[model samples]
Target: MLASLLAGLGLGFSLIIAIGAQNLFVLRQGVRREHLVAVVAVCATSDAVLILLGVSGIGVVLQAVPWLLVVVRWAGAAFLLGYAVLAARRALSPSGQTLSVGTAASPPIPDAGGTALRTRTTLATTVLTCLALTWLNPHVYLDTVFLLGSVASTHGDGRWAFAVGACLASLVWFTALGFGARYLGRWLDTPRAWRILDALIAVVMVAIAVSLVLPH
Candidate 1:
């Protein structure tokens, strides 16, 4: 049982920590200290739910309905392309938003009676973007439902244990990534670093979008 759980945990971590768009977005938010908890919760929860669905035989059902994938594939491709453009614009014009760890340590300052409203708006926008990043991507379904689910099924009765282990892995990873990224705040304190990161995000998004549409 321990071995099965460990296998699931290890595989889950390997799949998730691959520096993809979602991971990058989470890390960026973590460093910025903006809606960190909501971002982590949504990502980890989404992973857990998707992995369990896959392990519970939804992968087989998806295989039976090929049209679903076709719809998802095109939709995901469109989303990714749109995100890539945003990333590219950001890269060209760095925001310098996350470069200062000082702002977080300091107490809140009066801001024309608009800070609270802005905070609420920012939080909502961040959560919605995280959701799109998590759910709108076809790769999530492919990896969590089809790939991981098929692999879990091979474990027979141990697949449930494996699913639990995978869920734990998601929790561990997103938690670490969301919080641990704060430490890197010291390193990413420059416009150059932010620009480079955004550029890389653009490249990654465009590449993945192309892959989604290309014949496989």
Candidate 2:
């Protein structure tokens, strides 16, 4: 039981710790300190829910309906490509606040007047983006559902233990990533550093998009 649990934890961390769109977005939000809690909640909760569904044998049902994956593939690729273009623009643009960070990081609250309204709007947009990234990606289903589910099914009566371990792994990873990103804010204070980060994000997004459309 302990070995199964440890294996589950290790597998979960290995998958979640990879550099991906979801991680990139979460890191950016963490650095900006914008809706950090909401973003982390959405990511961690989504992973936990998916892991549960996988362990509960939903993976078999999904495999039987393979067409569902095709739809998700197209949608996810399009969304990723769009985000890549936006990131590239931010990297190239000279006079935008897209990637500008602060030397002293402090979470910005809704002030008075138009500023508060903008903040609310930005937060809403961020929340929506997080939802889309979590739900739309085909790789997420492939990893959390099909792959992890198959592995979990092998654990017999200890499947739930494995699932719990995976859930804990996701929670711990997101908590550390979302909270620890603030330390880099001081280094990213300059536009050059921000541009480099955005550029790297763009490259990753584009690579994922290509992989989604191309043959495996």
TM-scores of all candidate predictions against the true structure: 0.85, 0.88
Cα lDDT tens digits, model 2, 74-184, are 899999999999889878867434333323332223324313211122667888999888888998998898788889999998888888888889989988998999999
Off by over 4 Å in 2: 96-121
Question: Model 1 clash pairs?
Answer: none
Q: Rate the local accuracy (lDDT) of all candidates.
A: 0.81, 0.83
Worst 10 residues of 1 by lDDT: 112-121
State the weakest 10-residue window (summed lDDT) of model 2: 112-121
Candidate 1, superposed: residue stretches over 4 Å from native: 94-121
Residue 72 lDDT in model 2? Answer: 93
Candidate 1 Cα RMSD after full superposition onto the native fold (Å): 5.0
Q: Residue by residue across 1-216, what tens digits does model 1's lDDT show?
A: 777788799889888888777998899888767789999999999999999999999888889999898888888888878988987876786443233223443433233553321122267788988888888788899889988898899899899888888889999999999899999867776667777877888899899889889999
User: Mind sharing the TM-score for model 2?
Assistant: 0.88
